[model samples]
Target: MTDCLFCRIVAGELPATVVLDTEHLFAFRDISPQAPTHVIIVPKAHYANAVELAQAAPALTGELIAAAGDVAKQDGIDSYRLVFNTGADAGQTVFHAHLHVIGGKPLGPSGLDLH
Candidate 1:
């Protein structure tokens, strides 16, 4: 996990605008946003994707989801999209397990058939 981008962020080797940080999670703004309000929430510990994280630490998955709500609330949005791209074909560019909190505007049909 030494070369993982998120691990670098969690360890402070890189810089990201932190949205939320906790004992088990770290959340930050996406460098290239997909929405008016776009943030990526991640576990401090590395997991390849959501499936891997769930398989390993099920309850931690709940924390990740709960953190997403907290993140959206803190950002002043009640309704939002929580996405986990589990694989390359699904648009998961980063290898680390992360949740995307996207909102802040009216979201209609979108890319990847997200209608």
Candidate 2:
């Protein structure tokens, strides 16, 4: 896990524009912004992906979702999109479990064509 990018971010070894930091979660702006307001919310604890995190810590998974909602409200965005790419084939460039909160604009349909 030492080489995990998200783990490094959580440990303060990597620099990230932090938006929210709770005892169990850390939310930061994505380095590569796909939308006007894009944030990546990750658990302080490392998990390979959504399935892994949900299986091991269901409560934490729920907290993550709630945190995303809180972030949307804080950003004053009533409509937003939450995306979780589970595997490499699904465009998960990072292995760590995280949620991408995208808003601040009228988004188009999310499809493979976009990628």
Which model scores highest in lDDT?
Answer: 2
| RMSD values, in order shown | 2.4, 1.8
Cα lDDT, all candidates: 0.88, 0.89
Instruction: Give the per-residue lDDT digits (tens) of candidate 2, residues 27-65.
Output: 999887877778999999999999999999999999999
Q: What is the lDDT of candidate 2?
A: 0.89
Using all chains and alpha carbons, the TM-scores for the candidates as numbered come to: 0.94, 0.94
Name the TM-score of candidate 1.
0.94
Instruction: Mark the regions of model 1 whose C-alpha exceeds 4 Å error after superposition.
Output: 112-115
lDDT of 1 at 89: 85
Q: List the residue pairs that clash in candidate 1.
A: none
Q: Which 10 successive residues of model 1 have the least lDDT summed?
A: 106-115
lDDT of 2 at 36: 75
Give residue 39's error in model 2 in angstroms. 0.3
> What digit string (tens of lDDT, one per residue) describes model 1 on residues 7-114?
999999999999999999999998888777888999999999999999999999999999999988898999888889998888888899999999998776666221
